[model samples]
Each structure stands twice: as structure tokens, then as C-alpha cells.
Target: MIHNKYFSEEQIKTRKQQMSSQWDTVLKTNEAVLIHSGEPIQKPGGLDSTYPFLPHPAYFWLTLRRRETEILLYSKDLGWIEFHKEISNEEIFWEGEKNDILISSQGKNINSLENFLENHRFSRIFHLGQAKDASPEAFELKTLLDKTRRKKDASEVSFIRHIAEIANSGYQKITSVLQPGMTERELQIAYESEIFRNGAHTVPYETIVGSGSNSAILHALPSQKIIKENEFVLVDAGADIFDYCVDVTRTFYSSGEMSSQHKDLYSIVLKAYHECVAMSKAGVFWRDVHIHSAKVITEGLLQLGILKGNLSDLIEKEIVSLFYSHGVGHLVGLRVRDTGQEENLNPKTYFGARLRVDLELEENHLITVEPGCYFMPAILESAYQQKKFYDDINWTELKKWYDIGGVRIEDNILIKNDGNENLTNCIAKTEY
Candidate 1:
């Protein structure tokens, strides 16, 4: 029933109007905007078949229709006008336009764009296209559009929550089937199978299933490498059925009885995750929250004798980044990596630059709060050569736990005025 309502004509129209309403609120008095649904190109080297036509997110959010060469024009004088090409008889014969019944029938022919532009000129034209090949006016409003979309409406929130439930099914399935000598690719297959079985449209990204030492590779592709006993299996994946998608990560230790050392390492990541997520609220600077997450991890490391120094001094020197790389999280919306570029307000340093969003965390803003502690070989080897933190970091202690690989705990968070909601909390972080 929910799936049926998700694709209903009423819901589709409501979403289109939502985009128009947002545009009108942000649009200047004398501005006209053009959102282009990019043209199609065939695959390279004389192939007739084209790559899948994915409409621009801005265009898709507005129209909820995926037609190539479609243009949405907004002007103060004309209100909102959709210039779209009707499905041709030849194309309709091939695939059939079954879903056209839900679309508006009042759109102008796409060919009339030339005349429309000539007659309907405004002070500034905001042209939005693929890869943000947009006019200065459009580029200026990119962050605003991002913010507007980030704050999901009631229905949008429901859709995100529903997809998360399906994703959690996948996570749960992996635990039941987890065993020694199971290949990374096999685990990926098991997880993805459950996601699809639970009614996900598709696995949003290349499913990450890295085990043992390979788990240290953040974006490692699922391979035939065996998931050994007493090591972490890091699975970072999501279920995508609607335009909104959720990015989630869970690290599972293969053995039933995790050693005390491994448990301590994971506890540090969980501690950071809780501290950073607690800071999520309206008007909180995300960068500060991220640094706080690092501080929490640094404190945890100090407790375990991995790093020996004053907490503030270690953080000030960024010795924490040696293990805890990447930001606390980023916005997750239409795209899993749904962060918008903050105009003239980005982190310049090596550590802070990793954070995607610079905006003050706000109500209704849905984001990922993933805190991780990885013992990556490349990063550690380079840091060892640099000899920058010889005293700050206990080299022998760090090497002792190298086999544990990486540990990450991720959950989707919906920000609120006072606090936040954990959207993916239904999925267990640890089984034991």
C-alpha cells in the first residue's frame, strides 16, 4: 500500500509543486530560471545503446518525471512553465509510455525553447544543467536549493524511513549467515539479496564488503578474499527505491567471542559516534561537532594506550587523524553523498577539509553520523616515515592491533530543533 501511494499521481504532483513553491520563495523579483534535463549520449566506440538517462536531481525533484531534453522554466512574469517533448510514436512503440498518465498534459513542446527565451528575457537567467554547468545566477542558488531539498517534508521522511527498514533487513541477514571462510563477495551477495527481496529498487552504491586487513580499505570492492575468524567485516551499503537514499555502515566481527582488545577498539568508535550525534541540533556548527567526535576518539585511544599525550594537545596536533580519518558525516538525500558545496565557507586545513557540509546543523536536515577508527596501512606507514608523532603515538601498541583492521558505526540522523532522531537505529550496531 505504501509502495502504491509512493508512485501515486497525487504524490507525484505534490512533489512537483513542492519544488515550484521552494523556487518561488528563493527566486528574485526579476529572475528567470531554466532547469535542463540533459540530452542523451550513446556509449563510446560506435555503440548504438545509450547509457541510462538520469535526469538532473534538481529537475527530477521538481517534475518527478524522467524525460530527457525536458526543461522547466520559472519566471516572475509567467509563473512556472514546463517545456517538454511528448513521447514520439516510434519511441513509444519500443518501450511504451505507460507512466505518462501521471504527468501533466499542459507542457509546451521542447522545440519552442528558442522563442520562449527570446520573448521572456529577465534581468538574470539562471541556467542549471548537468555537473552544475550552470550560470552564475544558478550557481549562487545551488546551496539554497541544496538546503531546501535537505530538509525533507513529512512524506519524504517516511520514504527515507521505509527504505532504511529494507536496508536493515540486509544487515540482519548478513549476521545470521556470517561464518569463517565466507568470501567478501559472498557476503555482499547475501546482503544485496536481502535488500532486493525486501523491495529495494537497487543497491545505491557499489556494496562495500571488506574483511580482515582489507577492511582498512574504506571503499574496498567486495572480493573473493575470505572473511577470516576474529576480524572485522565492514559493510557499507544502502537501499535506494525513491529519489532519497540512506548510507549506512556496520562492522561485524566474524567470531562469536570478540577479544577484549577488539571490543575496546570498537567501543572507541561507538563513543565518538554517540558524542557527535548528540551535538546534532539546529544552529550547531558541523565542523565543531566533527572535531568533537575526533576528540572523543582521541580520548578513547589515550585510555587504551594507543596514544600517550594531553587530550587537547594531541587533538591540536591532529594526531587523532592518524587513525580516525574522514568527517563525522555529511548530508544524505536524493544522492547518498547528498552534500552541497558551501559557497566561500569550506575548511582549508587537511583535517577539516574532509568534512562535506559547513552549514550549521538545522532542523529537518537528514544526514549520516558515521564515526570510524581505521588502522590503514598506507596512512600509518606514511605517518611513521614523517616521524611527526613518535612520542604522541605508541608505535608498538598501534602495531599490536593492526590485524583488527577498521571499525565504523554509521546511522542516518534527522536533525531537530532540540536534538535529533536516529533514522537507522532500528539496525543493530553490534550483535553481541
Candidate 2:
């Protein structure tokens, strides 16, 4: 069913052609393909209840269908063949009537699995991922698909742009109604309802609404604690539209006015955010961008009397990890953290260890540039005990902002040939 009408028939056709061309380039001799659409799982201890059905990312990338127990077959001779299970009257009674959007787009190549397998034979069957009851050979097709899918096509870009718009709308709605005394869960409801009202059926991930000290915890879940005046509210959320997602994060001041210290920290994070986006372009190494962000954070901390050593020495010593722990950004597309074709560096340092994607930037690549600073008590105490920055640290000044929580500014960007496009730029960085 085309509940969301953002994508058209032409767009779907173009996407299929792109996937076919990309797959043909990577297929080897005597390799036939079988890509499975996964099924829904039952909830533990719930009678006849199941979790929401989500199609495999690769399967959705290929067919744009969310139905379970479907199989896609591909061979050099036969091309694309979709084997979908026929809907029964019992299914229709329970789940309503099925739509023919997928079938009409797939054409006459659709058939039953039994008939498809009986008519065609393959010396070697290679499955994209694990498929039930199939002993198919595993090849490098998964890696190839990941690499090919990194660069979004026009249709994919358009879809993501729509998703960005929805997410931006949600942020706007949440900010307008934000007030002191509201619980974090209430804020989450405000954000999610706005997204759904704007036409997104699902959020890409959990809606993060961290208030006060809770904001210091990365990936903090919504809690019952009431938001107090002058506290920092960090919201990181995304809208999922047709499997494509756009991640965005914005930190807000509950009282609509930032304290001097908070303003300084916010300015530093915003500066690092803009600098990272400016540096994002084809041929530039993502790791270099991350290092530059770290340097900016380190300089900001030094200016605030939090560190006393040379900037370069502090960055080299990974002292910035004491505040900015996660990576500067990551690949954002069909998956929030889209798989990078290359392997991560996995540096031993705290900051470097959090790097999600270490590949070079390329045209058509979609990524998120999020730079954050937090004053987590445990991490600070651990670093202090370990003597990681004992010589360079200024403990007194740091303690003043220890309970300030965190501040993060994130935006989605699409790398282009000439420059890049900021998809989430339409959303404001601050309430003012």
C-alpha cells in the first residue's frame, strides 16, 4: 500500500534500473541470486502479538516492498523475478485488502516460489543475507551492495529531502510548545506526534529528549524528570520515509535564554558543526574532518580555562575525548548509520574509538555532521583518576559547568560535485 505518496511510479522504475545496473557489474560467473524479505517476529509473552514488520534494508532498497516471505531472484539470463506469496482471505479479513502497487511495478515477472524454482535451475545460488531453509552460498554481494548504495540516486535524494522536511517540521512544533516543567516523555510525545502529523509513519530511531543532567548521557532515553528553567534539552531524532532516513540533532535551552557559560559552549559546538560541514566535500578524508572538529573543541576548552597545555599537544594526547567523546559525524541514508564500504580505523583513544565511518567523502554521499560536548561525571572522574590529562587540566573551572549536561548541533548534508547541500539547514539551531 502506498500510504505515503511521496514516491511515484517513474521514480520506482528508475530506482530498480539503477539497482540492476549496479548488481550486474558485481555479479560473477555462475552466480545466481536470492534476496529474502524478512518476516515479523512475535513479542515475548504476548499472545498472537508481533513486533512491527520491517523489511530488510537491502530488500527494500531493491523492491521498495515491506511484505514478508517474499523472494527476489536474479540471473544473467532471466533478469529480475519477484516471488510473492498470494494473499489469502483470512489475511485480508485481518489486515485489510492488499495493494497492487508492487505487483504492477514488477510486471509479469512475478510468480510463485515453487513455479519459479521449478522452471529455473542454477549451479550456484548465492543469497544476499541469511534466508530461511536456504543453504545458498554467501558471496561478496553484501559488501558490493553496501558500496553501491552509498551514493544516492536522484529518487533516493528526493525521498530523503522529504524526510528531512518532515523531521524539521517536528523540531519546529516541539520547540514552539517547549516550556519549563514539562517532563522528557512529554517532549518526546510532542516531537513524535508532530512527525506523524506531518506524514511520517515511523521514526528512524528512538526520539531522544534528554533534559538537564540527563543530556550528558549520549543516547539518553526519555525520562519522567521534569525539565527545569535554564536546563539544556537535547533532542536527536529522524523521520523514516520509505526506508530512507535523515538524522538531525539540536540542543535547546529550556528557558529560551542561555547562561554565559552555556552560550560559550553552544557557540563552540556550533562553530565546530559549521566548520565540519564546510570541510565536507569529495576527496576529503572523513577522519581529517573529525580531527579538525576535535581541534576546534580543544581550542574552545582551552579558551574557557579548562586546559593549560599547548593545543596541539592536548589534541595529540586525546584530551578532547574528555568532553567530546563520539565521532564528529557518520554516513546517513537508508540506515541512520549507513554501512561504510571501508573498515573503521578503531583507534585506541577514547575519541578515536567512537569514529563510525572513516572513508573519504565522495559526490552524492549523504552524511551527518554532528559535533557535541558533554560534562559527564563518570567520564570526567575516570579520566582524572587515570591521570590522562592531570598536568593540563583546570579542575576548578570545569566543575562549574559539570552539571550543565551537553550541547550538540547536527545537520544533514549531501555531498555534490561542486559543493554540498545542507538538507536540515531549514531548521534553526537555536530558539532565538
Model 2 alpha-carbon miss at residue 118, Å: 4.3
Whole-model lDDT, model 2: 0.79
Cα deviation at 33, candidate 2, in Å, is: 1.0
Q: Supply the TM-score for candidate 2.
A: 0.91
Which parts of model 1 have CA positions greater than 4 angstroms off? 1-4, 7-30, 98-105, 121-124, 131-134, 342-345, 350-353, 383-386
**Candidate 2 clash total?**
0
173 Cα displacement, candidate 2 (Å)? 1.8
lDDT by residue for model 1 over 233-342, one digit each (tens)?
89999998744688999998898888898899888888888888899998898888887888888889999998897988987888878887788888886778764655
- For each predicted model, how many residue pairs clash, with residues at least 3 apart or on different chains? 0, 0
Please give the lDDT score for candidate 1: 0.79
